[model samples]
Target: MLRNGQILFLCALALLTLGVLMVTSAGMQIDQASAEQPILVDGGLSPIAIMSGRTGMYAALAIGVMGAMAFVPQRLVERAIKPRPGRFYLMLGVGAAALLGLLLLVYLPGIAREKNFSSRWIEIPAPVFGTLSIQPSEIVKWSMLGLLAWCAVSAGDRLRLFWRGLVPMLIVLGLVCAVIMKEDLGTAVLIGAVGVIVLLAAGAKVWHIGVLAPAATPKPVVDRLNAAINKLLALPDVKTKLDRIGVVPMPETPAEFNKRIQE
Candidate 1:
């Protein structure tokens, strides 16, 4: 029997694979800059011009990490809820802090890479990738759940308290969202939603989570789009028409929807 977590991983991997294949199959074209220069075509694959190589490399890296995590022991994962002796700067104790530091580096002039008016990536030159761009927010997003879990478990019964238990986690969530929002509002909203949900499941008070609720964070255009699509798919006629065309209706969470958009 597949566990819920396993099912979720499978779904995510399926989406990633679909994106990789779609990108790899994109038709290649001649180098437009060199189009005026002499060109030779020897029946080689010319249509893979886009970001096929780079996309595949990153996709493979993601899949590899996921595969590794799958085999990790559950006890080890649970043990990670608490930090190790004397070394309090690891995943459990300071994971969020470490990620926060890395994220702040995005504002450090020369190293920061900007695109579309956002400074969310740090560019590092690498062998095959030419210039490898690392988004610290992506790392933080993946680690936040475990960090929140640690926070909740650490808080224990204190979680029932208003200021003591949840506020610290809320601060972490706020800092991350605020930093990411300066560049990527969509992701900031997504992280906020996930953080609140995780804390709620961990026994946080409804009103406690609601403390940060007033924020629409300027706007999360992707989540809004996803919600609208779901409302449309809820209608019987829309569902029937899609079925006739062999279009299966799959509602994605904000995270997954954001990924599809990024791809």
Candidate 2:
């Protein structure tokens, strides 16, 4: 019988397989439509077909990666965490520099690509045909998590100390979130929350995480959030849904929202 982890992995792989099938099925109509167009006939495959193929290929790659990480020798991973002269520093330096470079690339003109009024992706040349747009923030989030774990492990018992341990970790976290927040506030907040949780799990004090609450939602941010929510609620589809449900539509004042939530 498969163990819990094995079962979970199988379930995730199944879901990924299902997603690939669905994408390909949806693309088939586009492929058929392209088949009828004489101009597009010379282009080989339709754009949707190409995208679906790429999605399946990526899903396969992801499964392989997950399997490798899951079944790799534990001792090998342990060896990475084991302390050696300049080893930890070298790892930290490389990870930090790569993350910062990717983040900075999102701000450079002609390199950063904007979509939906947000400049948060960078285009990298693909092996074939077109460029692939990637959100650096996604990669940085995982790197930051691994970096935090490395720092905590490297710190050893020093991680228990407020100055020697928590301060430096907080500093690193602050810098990462600061850079990411300029274009992706949502991702920055998510990274910050995860970093704090990891720190707490690694033995940092509770108040250290609590102190971040005030800064989590500043007045201007709350106002902007409210405005955005109001705008979204005013959209045609959203208004129709609200009307069908017979619930009062949004754009409520603070007091009205609070009252509604309480009830």
Candidate 3:
């Protein structure tokens, strides 16, 4: 019988294979303006050429990475990551600071790049790869998780104390979320949700979790929200449901939504 890890590995491999096939067939469709640029491919420049080549390379690299991580012994992995005797807080502070600094680079001109109107990747030039970009938000997601785990482990017996254990961890988590929220609000929310799960697993008080309620959406963000009636009216499939409800949809800010819910 295939082990659980082996089954997961096979599933991942199948998904990656499907991705490679899609890239190979669909190819990227860049605009004529960008196509004129020479950065895409070294000798030959075309949509299919660039995507097929890069995607193939990335798939190979990903498979190798997965293999390496899967084979590492659990005990050695724990020892490498586990906090040292005296430097738990120091390690968390330094590591989070370094990651935050890296994440901030996504805003720098020439170094930062955008995709789908989101500025969240840093560009790097490599001899073999030509041009490569790294998503600092992806790193921030996992690093925040690691920081939460470290906080939980370090807190240990003092986890019940409000000031001694919980407050400090909450501050760090908030800081990480705030930084990530600048470029990727969706991802920051996901990180916060996962952090809550980690905290609860670590035996944090339920009331303490309740204290971290979701904040109201910003005014600028509220202004950007489309009217609910417009959206509902546009959906042909739900028109009957809306008619039967006999309720009118109106534009409302997030604060208004909260107020109505409370009422």
Candidate number achieving the greatest TM-score relative to the actual structure: 3
Model 2 segments more than 4 A misplaced: 1-9, 21-52, 66-74, 81-93, 209-263
- Alpha-carbon TM-score of each model against the true structure: 0.59, 0.62, 0.64
- lDDT per residue for candidate 1 within 127-223, as digits (tens), equals 8778988988898887777787776766666777866666767877888778887887666656676777788888986645432223364347655
Answer with 1 or 3, whichever has the higher TM-score. Answer: 3
lDDT of 3 by residue, 105-152 (tens): 999888899889888999999886779989988988898888778868
Candidate 2 C-alpha lDDT tens digits along 96-141: 7778888889878877998888888988877853577789899998
Model 3 TM: 0.64
Backbone clashes in model 1, listed as residue pairs: 27-47, 28-46, 28-47, 28-48
TM-score between model 2 and native: 0.62
> Candidate 3, 23: how far from true, in Å?
5.1
What does the lDDT come to for candidate 2? 0.71
Span of 10 residues, lowest total lDDT, candidate 1: 42-51
